[model samples]
Target: MSSIKSPRQIAESLTELWSPRVVAEVDDAYIKVAKVQGSLAWHSHEGEDELFFILKGRLRIEMDDGAVELGEGEMFVVPKGVRHNPVAESECQLMLIERKTTQHTGNVVTEKTRSLSDQLRPV
Candidate 1:
């Protein structure tokens, strides 16, 4: 049976910033939701690209090349091995799609990092 999930509801239920909750899965990729604010550490995923879909507010993905701004209902894909950081001037809701093995913080682990196990818990 397929379970119906609401990314917005899950994102809103999140009590921790930058902590993503797994809401669904498609093959080897996991669909996750997160409530974000401020900035996340600069990092890169060497083996998998990350997909970010904006659900609410605005998001700016900063890279050495430049920064890409995304508004509600927009999406962006950060290629593998690219150094990037996600930033939101205000609280933003986001949905992410990435390989199951993708690290929460890529190569840079911070105090805000949450493990995959933690992300799998119920929202």
Candidate 2:
């Protein structure tokens, strides 16, 4: 059986970096934490929507239709198959939630799309 993990524990295990670290999983979805700076690649998940919550600093999401800016405590959802890019001029802490099988960078497959394999804990 999987053991329960608290948010504090997950935070402690995560290292501050531009890439995301899988922190928790619940059924089909996984929670990923990341410290982002600069721009993320443009891409879209073919089969799942993605949710991003800004824990600290600011984030800007650019899409083909428009752009949305999120501040600390703000959240947004990118619908499945919609092309989007995330940017942070300064360091930003964020929580990403999506299907467990979802790729971090969709089909882009760039070096920046590295995954935090097996890091997710059940809580």
Q: Identify the candidate with maximal lDDT.
A: 1
Give the per-residue lDDT of model 2 (tens digit) for 23-71: 7677889788877889989999999999999888899999999999999
- Report the error of model 1 at residue 24, Å: 0.6
Cα-lDDT of candidate 1:
0.95
lDDT tens readout by residue for model 1, 1-123: 997888988898888999999999999999999999999999999999999999999999998899999999999999999999999999999999999999999999998888999999987
Task: Write down the lDDT of every candidate, Cα atoms only.
Answer: 0.95, 0.80
Runs in model 1 lying further than 4 Å from the true structure: none
**Number of clashes recorded per candidate:** 0, 0
